[model samples]
Target chain A: MNGISAEQLNQAHQADLAIQSEEGVVFEHAWADPDEGVIYCLSDAPSAEAVMRIHQRAGHPADEIHAVPLEV
Target chain B: MNGISAEQLNQAHQADLAIQSEEGVVFEHAWADPDEGVIYCLSDAPSAEAVMRIHQRAGHPADEIHAVPLEV
Candidate 1:
């Protein structure tokens, strides 16, 4: 997330996409602002740990993962 | 984005929701980490500026906005 470029972020996304289903996670989408030293991933997974684990395996562990509210 | 609490974030979200339709934005979902001093919004809007202008009007302008990748 920090000191990374858009190209690197997408590279990591591709890596996660390669192994996500085996991890019981769906790589829905990602957003990042390298200027802010952060990347955000939105996914369908049972747990935040599952999401984190996938990213770790992909060599892109998330800085934080929060379940988003689906409705107001 | 900084020095704000979850309650305040929700308050801002509600404000945006009140005027989003007219602003040409659909408030899809939102995520925040008060500890990180950041809030992330996922919406269907014409442009990032549209998103920002709405939030600005709501008094919680976004710090950064990026078009997320839909596919690898």
Candidate 2:
């Protein structure tokens, strides 16, 4: 969480949306754990690399990427 | 990701759902990175502790818990 404020997350999310279309990524949801300095975002993308690219361009590169092929 | 399979995640998710009602937790989604040995789950719960409790009862205690109060 590293003292990240709601405003910062909102701004980052907005930035992500702005550039996502270029990568065929649709950000669905985001959750922040400010206490843990962690953020979790749900998105639809062509691949895990696409998600990471968007995040990197948005100015916050993800620490890890996981492919979610199945949902229940 | 640790070689965890989709079936394993499905089983854990089902177990969480079975006992979540007692703790006021609703697991919404889950994503697994078997290669990374990590599982990320999204849930609606009274608190981070409540979510952890449900996961624990289901036999998969989360390594970390984050409160997601904002979404985009």
Candidate 3:
């Protein structure tokens, strides 16, 4: 995972807050490392690309998107 | 991030459920990508090392720990 940048954080933060308007997805949570330019997000979506699409649409393409099966 | 394995997952799962016995830390959530061998964890602790220490003691040391100033 690449470090998150402030630009990415701003975009992700906005995306998380605004994602309810999107389809086939709901942004659950986001983690940012401003110094490392890495952004991690948790979301309910059909596929990894769906999550990336949301971020791309929000003007922040993720460095990588891995499926995380939540176990909590 | 390195991928998570079944063995690591079991350790982390048990650790999550058993962390209440530890000090200065609270396991909030865990996400595992079993196929990719990556495990992401969210926890409340005084520092990143606190989270790692708990995991290390639990027998599944995390590959990375990033501070996420959660907004929701």
Candidate 4:
């Protein structure tokens, strides 16, 4: 996937306002493995720390959360 | 993601030789949703019909399996 631009991230953050109100925080893309049962996702939060907080609050704590761009 | 080329699919089928020996057939990319508990994947099977057959045998049959390329 192309790297998300700062402007895009900002827009995503703005768009997530509604989701944040309901789901707490919305991840861009999230998926889990059937066999391994591991979930992975990309979130546009204020910071990597915020991403972890979101996951923690969701009760599905991430096994690994990286502050990196997702490559397709 | 780029569309799987006929040659790439052929190579993948050949490379999956080892997996087919054990797991029956291998999918290219697969993911599931934790909350939704739905799985999605890309498979380069002999035919669309074959793709469904693989999923049926896997037990967690697909809810929607399209014969379209996955866009990253």
Q: Pick the candidate with the highest lDDT.
A: 2
The CA lDDT at A71 in model 1 is: 25
Please write out the lDDT profile of model 4 over residues B1-72, one tens digit for every residue: 134344543443444343442433557654333333334465655655666665555443556555432211
Candidate 3 on B1-72: residue-level lDDT in tens?
355565666666776558744668888777777767666777777888877777887777777787775333
Error of 3 at B24 (Å): 0.6
lDDT of 2 by residue, A1-72 (tens): 477788998899999999999999999888887776888888999998999999999899998778766566
What's the TM-score of every candidate structure? Answer: 0.61, 0.86, 0.75, 0.34
Q: Point to the candidate with the largest DockQ.
A: 2
Pairs with steric clashes in candidate 2: A1-A34, A1-A36, A1-A37, A1-A38, B1-B33, B1-B34, B1-B36, B1-B37, B1-B38, B2-B37
lDDT of 1 by residue, A1-72 (tens): 446776787798889888888868998887765655667778888888999999899887777787653323
Name model 2 segments beyond 4 Å from true: none
Worst 10 residues of 2 chain A by lDDT: A63-72
- Give each prediction's root-mean-square deviation over alpha carbons: 4.9, 1.9, 3.9, 13.1
User: Quick one: best TM-score, which candidate?
Assistant: 2
Candidate 3: where are CA atoms >4 Å away?
Answer: A1-11, A16-23, B1-11, B16-21
Backbone Cα, N, C clashes tallied per candidate: 0, 10, 12, 2
